[model samples]
Target: MSLSIYSIDLAKHSFSIHGEDTNGNTLIHKTISRAKVLTFFANLPPAIVGMEACGSSHYWARELTKLGHTAKIMASKYVAPFRTGAKNDLNDAVAICVAVTRPSTRFVKIKSAEQQSILMLHRARDNWVHERTALLNQIRAVMAEFGIIAPKGRHALQANIGHVLEDAENQLPDLARAILADCYDHLLSINQRIADQERCFDMLVNHSNNAQKIMKVAGVGPITATVVIASIGKGEQFDKGRDFAAWLELVPTQYSTGGKPRLGRITKKGDKYLRTLLVHGARAAITNIGNKTDRLSLWCKGLVERRGLKRAIVALAAKNARIIWSLLRNDTEYQVAV
Candidate 1:
């Protein structure tokens, strides 16, 4: 049978595939074991294959592309509207099949193995940081139970924790002191791991031309630069900087009626990690923009004065996203306007 398009509902062990002909008639709908997936597709003629952007979807897409098929991955939300009946693997496969054929559907850009590896490092670092935060909070709460209070910041806690444990006159029981000591040790270990991950990011940024270029922009550090490179290689997937910013969901949400435009706060719908990094970076840039007369700096100064600090931070973040996109898309250096 001549297959025109194939949609796959991917899973750990089994995958449901829906195949259609040129006339949109369903030709094959069946579940296959993981091991046989590539073999099955390899046997068929090269065709357009679609899958939702979920865990392992990129791997499958890359594998399908290797078999001469045009692989496309769409967001799960985009595929949801195309589902006709009850939700299941087969129905999802059919929905993907239908969604892939639509011109308006936006597909995910496939990440290479190297990109995935960098992102893996990022995930590891982020996880370790969260673990450290939880450990800090737990330690503080336990200490507070015994009428002990550590200072406000992590640095203060680190500095005073040893003193707290060593002081014999405090309310902390021997057992509690031991436990708190253990917790502090664990926090130190987590901090070490996070530092190691950040060093890895630095090494990656040093090697990547794209990372280096984006890092030239204000508010973008090694972490942000490496993540952007991993997430979107050259930014070619986006037509313009504004589209890239919108993809990051840094743009405002819109609700228009009767030709009246109504815009609300940012959609905040895409990768929260990326959005957060950008915002934090923007905040840092704004804090350090002292008496600079450059065009970008002046604009940021004006924005902060006109819109207040919080909105200014977000606007600067969105602006940084656009600037990063432009640098990556054009393969050029960032120029500070006078």
Candidate 2:
């Protein structure tokens, strides 16, 4: 029996699909509307379909699955090698078709609607945080021109906002005051939007079994759990827990020759957003806010004492990612050396 493979190059409004049969022949080639992709897939013979994991790839994966096609999403990096010369939709599609049939290629696991939906909140929250930071920076830059200096940190700046606004003795011109006030208002609105998104995240994670299980580990909270789960997707895609942490770029980059290994900074390979969450979560765990003690806290505190706070946070986040993998993969609850 021979298997056929198809590759699709997607765009904003149109896409090109190229197919190659087991006999090394171009079986099909065509361009179609983005809106009509699923309909087209339903009419084609059931075969393996490959598309770059960009934009709305997951949604298409789910739809194709429903239509009985074995669709797989390959990351663009993996598909890039096959594309030679100039890049165009047709050539890209042909390259994808070529790449998918390779013996040792990796494919992204298709995420469910619930996974994507939950992830949307994290994305939305992150955007709002970025907007807030930009707004604060604009306020700071604008105020500095008038000799107004506020302390570092969001809390410090926020605490001084009222004082700055009320202090008439300060040399801030009326125009400066008006601009700062508008920026401050924008910052406040962005913060509120972020808080709202977090609430949605809380609701979604509270409803997930995996999220609850992972959260039992110290340093894993609602946000951390959401980040870890969404970033890793299905844990089975990784060979082991360490692989997941390394994918998160928490592991050190290695330079080794002839069995002598030298590790540098973390490779920083995967989702930076999730990596940041875990690091921050690790910081809180070491803070030990609840005066609660657990194996995770013990590990985090030990690292902090040995490696200092920042490095310790990174180490603990790396450790937490592995523990999360264990919990999710083995289907076990968190325990203190049980």
Candidate 3:
């Protein structure tokens, strides 16, 4: 019988696939090279296809979808439980087949080429920032060896570096000065690269209507605005604003039994980069909310007085996540609560 469903365990150069008939009987099982995957699927009757959401899974999903197959990307954890025996490509393929048929299984949203392109820019900027921080920390450690203590914080270190290098009274040797100068020069170059990446983000934000609409919320700047738009796309998968926020892991986690509910801290389960940006934006909004009578600002002050600073900042971020969902899902502008 022609297979009614299929699961693929993907690899760089090869793949393992398991197919099942409508009665849940195994119909076909085989290994094929990566080059043959699409051609094989294109010939097969259109059916449900499942794969783990890793590596090039999104790219494959998009491709398969173009071929009329309903491709579903499952997180590895969810598929792990369905493995019947020892781990192998065959077992993993079978597991994916089983997991995809389950009603409760959560699937990853397939991202477009443009979405992945935006994410590439974000990841590149992150790498440059990490390299910059490492260089700065190395400079700080080298300076400390000479018994010269620069005050804490990046701004302070930048302000004190020139003075430390210029002062002869610090008794810094020539070789040490040369090494530090090299580190400082590299640090400046990395900073310029980071600035250039931010300019790219600004250009993306200027061209995206969704980015502009979301930025109307107080805390969201260009980076946060563009990231949210890139990450969530149209937000059609989420039925409500809270569902979107929960996906971002901004909602409180729950542990309940015996008809009782015990809620714990926020789940922190979604994209770490997006969540961090939202939190940082929230903190900035909190810092700048000085005696403003607007509903958001007034609410922020009251929350600060009640739950204190950190909790209030998180609460605000969660609120912003919900608002972000509303804007993206409905394609509407943000309206302040009056």
Instruction: Name the candidate that leads on lDDT.
Output: 1
Reference-based lDDT, residue 166, model 1: 89
Task: Give per-model CA RMSD.
Answer: 1.5, 2.7, 1.8
**Structure candidate 2, residue pairs in collision:** none
* Overall lDDT per candidate, in order of appearance: 0.91, 0.82, 0.90
Best by TM-score: 1
Once fitted onto the true fold, the runs of candidate 3 whose alpha carbons sit more than 4 angstroms away are 1-3
TM-score quality measure for candidate 2: 0.88
Superposition-based RMSD of candidate 1 using all C-alpha atoms, in angstroms: 1.5
- Pairs in steric clash, model 3: none
Residues 182-211, model 1: lDDT tens digits: 998888888889888888988997788888
Candidate scoring better on TM-score of 1 and 3: 1
Looking at candidate 1, the ten consecutive residues that score lowest on lDDT are 1-10
- lDDT by residue (tens digit), candidate 2, 54-106: 97888888888898888888888888898987888988999999888877788
Clashes of 1: 0
Q: Once all C-alphas are superposed, what RMSD does model 3 give against the true structure?
A: 1.8
For all candidates, the clash counts are 0, 0, 0
Give the distance in Å from residue 193's predicted Cα in candidate 3 to where it truly belongs.
0.6
